[model samples]
Target: MKNKFSEESIDFIKDHINDDPAEIMLQSRKFPELPMRDIVVQIASRQKAKNKLPEWFGNYELILPPKQNLEQASSEITAKFKARFVEGDSLVDLTGGTGVDTCYLSRKMGSTVYVEPSEELCAVSKHNFEVLGANIEVQNSTAEEILNHNLVQSDWIFIDPSRRDNAENRVYALEDCVPNVIVLEERLLNSAKNVLIKASPMLDIKKTLQQFSSCYKVQIVAVDNEVRELLLYLRKDNDEEADIEAWNISDKREEELFSFKYSYEESCGFDIEEPQKYLYEPNAALMKAGAYKLIASKFGIQKLHPNTHLYTSDELIESFPGKKLVIKEVLSPAKKEIKKRVKNGTANVIVRNFPMGANEIKKKIGLKDGGEEFMIFCETEAVGLRAIWCERV
Candidate 1:
């Protein structure tokens, strides 16, 4: 990557940094000497980074990748969370696309090597690393090439496989991902004492663990209640059942963490009862980890139904790992009953183990989307389907 854009182009980008990209493109004819298209890309990418990558957005010298790569790159919040696992003297990033993970991990290690097959991405990452003052070596080669040639050895290795196929379709299976960690598991373990793999949140955790011989831990990470990534941690000779951890990074920058042994959830027993005074719904991370029974047992709350994940308690459990709502009333799902109980024609609707979807129920009940109250629809063992009105605690 030679300096394709000149100093004038840089000044132009800085001058119109906050301008609309589409508007900038329409005014391209006025600025004939500047690289308007490239400048517009940088401006647009910077706008997208405003919230996701605040640190990078603050630094004008950093060269961000294209919109697609930026979208695939981990947010700064998640990158910082993943960096806590970094250990030892040296680290190797096997698939360093935009180098966001590598840049954060590099701060914790004595030395770091970033490997990516794309020459363009490698160049851009190398430039960004220099601008950010990160001590990293950029390798323009594939992970397989580096491992096969025995190019480098390190204490820890991290890889986030490409989740897209040649046709640009998204894939969720571990075997379907590029570099196919399933095939390279043995070699990766042989090269490093610990291997960390970032996977799609949609991947089945149990099936993914069965594909690996050394996986010892699995992390389901969510940001602001939305499940984001699934991490598989592998040790050289570990054979224990993988420990499962669910992390919900709240908007307040606090972590709502719950961890359990993979086998414990299957053996746990829970009590089934009707809706009580309060209702609890597990966060996205816990739901993705399949902790339905374990959560009820751990929290000492009764479940509404065997299949329904909603829980209830007579006493308020402030330490529950999810939303806590106080039940105002339990009424039939009939429109007339709901209308009589709920004077306001608006509520936040949530459905669990119910026949109709949330939108369908909302339409049937003639309710709008937003309000101070929540209408939770679920089935209990005693009463088949009931609508529980609640307010956030």
Candidate 2:
């Protein structure tokens, strides 16, 4: 059933808004006339949107979808990031579940179409778009059906396929997703000059590139040190190698970006050195972009190891894309050595490419986790395993 909020229900929701949603749900019996489930969903969704989508969350009339759609939907930050790549008279977003991307991207074009197969979601999106002052047409149709309808050509087309199956199990292969983009690639290219595809950040880039004959660029996006989404830009006639963009959209006001060519990363060689005066860890976006060697060569920094992504430089580079820290000391992972190196028997622990996990390492070394001091465990070609102790700069 479509979610509709009455004046009384809306008032009740506002009155009982609490930080503890589960505790509030116990009082659902008080409002039997209202869709208590949907009300709770709205309260929870708006609470999350307050931090994740501040712009849309501020509107009193803003409507939200169920928990599943809200969970899968893009944040305002990433939605606007995708919008910057498109500018034209018209664009169409296929597989527009909650229309989060469609809403933000539509602001860039003169005319836009939001097509979704779910009538309930389309209705909610239409109402919210009206509240946001976005002029757009909403269509209820599958991506494949719309592409085959002899539709009018548009400047750009967007697709974000459902990554889950009927049983709610996750699927990562392009062919496995609903309205499979890989199967409809030819039709999509024929329908527009540019096609933008969004996929799970966990999807392998190199393997995905092998699916298409050519691509314009691949954008690896992350927020607050967690990888979020991978955006693929496709052009019908473009035969050039794909350029990679690594964006750390951690801050709402500013973002850090690094771009590189895949060929440069493949052909170039990098130098590896022992622990230097400072250590640099590439952001989640750059690490997912797989530009390990390029980061070292382009920034004139030395890599600790070919396998380890951590970088080192004698001179400090504050503009580095990721976390930077002063190297206090390098020691062995042995319990005796760690106990002697760490002061106060406490520090923050991070384990990467190591056999032991953070908790296990902490326990083995007789240290508690949490302090200004940081301990990192990683593998190196010179040394099989080593521990780096430092403080954030």
Candidate 3:
């Protein structure tokens, strides 16, 4: 239902919920309507731990993300969406959660309308927008409701349809989902020239494209080494002629491909040459593009080895967004070799393309975690090798 809690109460509840949500969860169930009461109720409802501040905060842990999970509606999405925003056009972000994307567009667009359904979220967005001094209109309504309330003939419309995290949940296309992105695209684009939709990177990207028209571009964003988000760009014409381009984005650089994974892979067997003194690793995005050979040739760098995804040169190349590893010393993964390489008792350790765990490998060499030196136990295209005293290359 609509919100009954005041703006301050909602903020406090949400903050407590997200931060130490266990508390709020138990507290909320006790007093369902009162946000403050609900906090303690929800927390107590679950289970109680005899705890205090510092230790409670220390309860945080790490969880490995699935490959390409949440790749949609992340920093990459905001950056790319912001890149498209210009000075005069009006922009609308229909599902304005946290208003991250809306804040981005408001910076460049002449005007922006952020339509968020929940009053709590609307309050939050309004507060943030004010702090940023952004010229954005905040509406407490959903995308469907906003269409009825305002004549928002925006130049751009962004819709990030939520995907159930369960990969096997079985949503096949826009027509099958809630708010049906494909159907929504048709309606929104009728008024706006461009519409951007963010979808699960885990979903069958190809199937989604097949169900939608006027899709001009698709972007896969990889953070650090993990692929986290995906975005689809569509146009108003329902034009079948619009090019379907795939872009891979990483902090290093962005690479675009005309085709997709299967076709690109089938086209060629990678050709690898010996790595020069300077080695370039492809950024996360270009790697996702799967246009291995195309990007290598287009960028004018030689691949390190056929199986290896590294490029190298005698000359320093700053253009390639990947790490530049300067290979100083290489040794075997055996205890004797490792000890010899790190004989001076200084090295960092990394296990890559190796069956052994990092701790096992480090223990084998009597190497500890913190030091100025770096050690990487990785299998490169050239073959298996252990590197010590190597920096980010």
Candidate 4:
């Protein structure tokens, strides 16, 4: 690992901010002493961080990891979201990948410890945290080793296990993840009053709750419309049903929070009816929470089908937490009918629980995939699968 950063190498990286890595490598033939791969990786890492980690990306002195590691790091927005849950004097972050979560969350606590296995990453995190004016203790040790060693009891323990295994295999189960938060959940709770875990967005929430019954709250956080991470907050004595929160962060307005208990969603009843004037689709965070029925019942909207997870209402609900479309026509997915409706030969196609996928339907209907027109293909209790044509609101 390239842990040492020299003045000349830093200058070279700054000079070729926009240069292609291949071209830089070819040009590196002249200067064999410089670390070409490290410099190129820094440039690529900063480029990726531009959109995801704006604060670090804009700073020239901050050292960043490779693109893959940078991708694993949490965005400043998501980190701040996790920070809000932490209220304590001390926090110990085990498996601190890039220290993004540690840096943002440490601001709330007086004493924070960041534990990382990679020596190079620990060095980089120390430098970046220093540059950002955060006073966090960086430790170059594995989580297991630290927990087994002279570990002090902290108020909160945050662990974000590596999603990839030693063989670089992708793992989804909590037990499969590095440090195995599921196996160590009870141990962590013993060390701290609360244990907060940052899990993969793809990790099943229901399965996680089943594994860690002590979870008091499960937060599915999304930025704009994309689901990013699933944060699980666990306490030692949480025996009741956990509260589920779906948070969609937006810059235009305050964070849209849709909270409901899992039992409430399971026990809720929804109405199924024909397409109405307005059709609503739940946001990614809501979908991740599996609060399908609760959303429909709470919004007073009718569901297209039990499995469709799409809602419709006669009156426009301006405060809906997702995409709202005005229905223009509801027709069968017949090729002739679709062709007749899409005279412009271009439309945005969406397929859900339909026999023919979006691409197949697009090809069969002979329409290019670009337009203001929206073609929704979904199943209904009354009709198996039909196409609802609409305009985005």
Q: Kindly list the per-residue Cα lDDT of model 2 for residues 351-385, writing each as its tens digit.
A: 77888899888777777877678888998767779
Scanning candidate 4 in windows of ten residues, the lowest lDDT window is 143-152
Give the per-residue lDDT of model 1 (tens digit) for 1-393. 332457788788789888999999999999998778878888888888988999998877787887778876899989998999777899999999989999999999999999999999999898899888999999999999988888777899999999888998988787888989988988898889889999999998888887885989999999999998899999888979899999999558568999998779989999998888999999999999999999999889999999999999999998888889999998888999888867879888999999999989988889876867888899988899999999999
Tens-place lDDT digits, model 4, residues 1-393: 465578998888778877787788878778898888888888888778887888887777788888889767899889988888897899999988889999999999999999999888999888888888998999889888877764759999999888888898888678888898877776788889999988899988888888888999999999998999999998998888999999999766767789999889878998999898998888889988989998888889999988898899999988889888999999988889988988988888887777778888878888787878889999978777889999888
On lDDT, the leading prediction is 1
- Candidate number that wins on lDDT, 1 or 2: 1
Residue pairs in collision within model 2: none
Best by TM-score: 1
Candidate 4: residue 269 Cα off by (Å): 1.1
Measured with C-alpha atoms, the lDDT of residue 233 in candidate 2 is 92
RMSD (Å) per prediction: 1.6, 1.9, 8.4, 1.9
lDDT of 3: 0.58
RMSD of 1: 1.6
Q: What does the lDDT read for residue 243 in candidate 2?
A: 91
lDDT of each: 0.89, 0.86, 0.58, 0.87
Candidate 1 wrongly placed segments (more than 4 Å): 1-8, 251-253
Model 3's TM-score against the true structure: 0.63
